[model samples]
Target chain A: MTIAVPTWRNQVSPVLDEAENFTVVEFKGGKQVKSVLINLAGKSQMERIRQLEAIGADVILCGAVSNYYYNLVSARNIKLIPWLRGNVSTVLDAFLSNGLEHKRFIMPGCRRRRRMCRRFGQINKRKE
Target chain B: MAKKRQSTELSDKPRLTNEEVSAILNSIADGVFTVDKDWRITSFNKAAEKITGVPENEAVGEYCCDVFRASICETECALHSTMETGKPVINKAIYIVNSDGEKVPISISTALLKDKDGNIIGGVETFRDLSMVEQLRKELHGKFVFEDIVSKNERMNRIFEILPLIAESDSPVLIEGESGTGKELIATAIHNLSQRRDGTFLRVNCGALPDNLLESELFGYKAGAFTDARKDKPGRFELAGKGTILLDEIGDISPALQVKLLRVLQDGTFEPLGGIKTLKSEARIIASTNRRLSEMVNEGKFRQDLYYRINVVKLEVPPLRERREDIPLLVEHFIGKFNRLKGKDISGIAADVARILINYDYPGNIRELENIIEHAFVLLSGGVISKEYLPDDILHRKSEVTTGAFSNVDDFQKRMILDALRRNNWNRTATAKDLGMHKTTLYRKIRNLGIELPARDGR
Candidate 1:
């Protein structure tokens, strides 16, 4: 399977709206076999969609995406794993092992707010 | 502060036992758990229980994926992968459905747990709750309003600030905007704010009527003034006595009528058709046009002196594409408006619907946006407005969205300016520095581009 990750430096770009480069990693037997850098800067959204389709990526992993890009990407049969934040190498490794969930990858403030009262054995009143 | 106190209390306690380790794990704020090679949960922490909405007793001994219900469990197991690759994964972000079936976003980290013998045992995972971030993002969408007008765009906000003041004035206010840019709305606002608001507020579409009819309409016709003049009739000006008269499509008026209108604006006096006696108009004049009157003046289609006479105060409503920030607010406004008018209860618009709306250049401006919402209302039975209900032309307006630039010149320019402003943290100085231009030049570009400077809050 081939995974395309839009990158800034070595990590996934924070926002896909301005992402200009993508690192396509080809995996075989749950391991990275090959990787290539594709720069798609200065391209229209339609052209970018076509380029991604031509790349034949099975999935795209990136950070936050606008609604337009999300709809377009989903319209094509590409699986999108968005709102990810991590080094490209680590993220790819995690993907290969089915371990893409981790603390360092969470975007700020997306954590669930749970009632701590029950756990602490208090009155169980939820935090306001 | 509470967390600090808890940490201090924890430091006072002794450690180095299996039970102590388990207790410490449970006390940690982030959810932590250990999975055996078979993916069975060997240990579950208090934070894990709280985050997953399941008790430790229930979570223990169960398959990690079964307990957490993470989307990756059925497809890609992080612990399973961590076991295969000795390298631990750090800070992988994902979402999982909890006991209540709510999708909770989380960030997780995994590492191989080793015994005292230095042999790999089970894999450990830690995840932090990220609901606050998502909530904050949602909270930031709506909050722009000016009378009935809704917009976050700085230009619109500026116009909003001056709208009341403009309305209070008795001058011949010239409102220039593209079609559907709310020229008539602004004219109404001025009239509503003016002292003459209680009197008859009359509107005449100068372009909708020919020169002869427009002349008779503006200046009352006497009996036998024309073939249709059967009796003495009061024109829009006389009808709008002591009130406000909005001359819509003013640029479409003929030169002869322009001279007559210019005289009225110049001295508030005009002669009724077929009447030798001159009449005085107590009405306030407000002119609106989608055409560039200055260009018309240069083109010789419109009288230059008349343009100068009527353009006492000009309000230029920025096109929708130049003020994309206003799109969300406008969408919300339109949705509410249509909901009341159509008696339909659409909760809101889907993200995709908003995306398509914002991406559109809006050649027809706010009126087009209202029409789009009304169109959605016609098809929307209940629930939210989705892309399925959008007009076919808008849904199929194909353009690459990746660049965030539209084919419309105004849209592309505004996007560029906004992109740069955002990149520079909205600091015009830094933005100018990064753009390799002087600050004043940047300011001019911002003004020319119709980019509004945000309020004091810098939202």
Candidate 2:
């Protein structure tokens, strides 16, 4: 599985829309593999998504994302694990160890609601 | 113990206890929080808990960004700057997402905390919940918002009224307007309102590329079609499956490309380059252009049949000058947008600047107004955008503002057309021919520019 984490210093970027760089990790057979960073600075929301599509990230571990981006990411069939924060290595380790669901990595207040774990800080997109 | 405390105090006012300080912090309306040098929350007041929907215990030890989630927390943190520079930030506008995932607009001020010995400690940030104020603004903005587009213009509202009706159908939509009049926005609105909302919305600028490139972009190219084509590449129509494809600047497409587009609209089938088999596209087509397609057709510069094909449902988005009342609202919208983008706390434009904006003729439409505000933001450090912060052309406008109307032409094309009209002895048809434009187009330009034509044709 391939995972893309929008990075800010060592922590996950707080805002997905404004994220400029991503640390893409390639995982295979549940073991450590390859890791690389890609910069998407000055790219629009759609352009960023297009870059992700080209890269083929199986899952995206990210912080807060707006409804505009969340719906688009959901439509693209990419498993989005939003509201995750903390040191990149620690979060990656937690995800690898299957401890990602623990509240330690979840963003503040996301643990309050079950659905918020899926999409926190996003307005529910109107389906009409 | 109270009598003993009174005896200990030498000053006129008695010293308040820690509990009293806590009580004072809890009593006020604005939320207050102090963060240590490590960026961890050291103290979160009761008001902070109430505003954020996070309890004091939950937020006190957490990182400020995680607890606060302000729009600028990660990037342009006010507290971070205050801690670094020792300069306080006052009344910076921002929004934070609360525990319920609702965005709460707030104004925050940050200051450096100090110890009794003057030792540097942490940073204190006080935030005022602006929901009530935002609600007042929303009351003015809400009724006019249609989908993502905001407008109160009667004609635009009429378009907003019939958009759902238009979106429900599978007919090709033609959105005609001046550049920056938001033609593409209208297209997106139509697509989003349609049943194809879930499907990918692809936009291809028909005018931006060569005919061959545009053709390949619109129709999938088969392997071996070109030397670089190692494998078949699906085009926008193929990728837009069950979705909507917006062909922007359709008026600028070549005649040959226009035939292919017409074929797609008519038969919903097209063969890719170097492919014998035909493919069907179920994608809905919405075309937008700054040029007048009707005039293009009359001038024989555009395909008449293609014009009829895409003009099934026409929407003409008026320019900014036509919808002058929307300037203030759009100004507010752009101000809020730029504040978030630039991480500054500009309140709004000055009253005189607002007057200048309202009365000015925006030839470049809404986009020009937005750029003007964005340019002003680049110069302003904080506070409201005033006249001095505006662009030079806007500040030093030619001609006197005697009646709040410009006597001189603002658009360069207006001056060129006037010179052409004079050179052609004021014969409009001859002038249009000389300018390589249709007479009606020239006539419309004259009317739009407020050019007072002489009664005598001078033919």
TM-scores of all models?
A: 0.47, 0.49
Q: TM-scores for chain A, candidates in order?
A: 0.81, 0.85
Candidate 2 lDDT tens digits, B136-161:
56344331123346565668766765
Q: Candidate 1, residues B1-459: lDDT per residue as tens digits?
A: 999999899878875899889878977899999988777788889988877776787667765654675645533567878888988888788876554333567888899988757788889999998755544442342211124454546676556656666766777889999999888777776776677767877889998998888888889899998888899998888899998888999999988898899889889899999988899999998899999999999999999999998898988989887877667657755664565455677766764565577788788889999899889888876677767788988877635333343546566456545644643336576455544568898789889878987562111
Docking class of 2: incorrect
DockQ of each: 0.02, 0.06
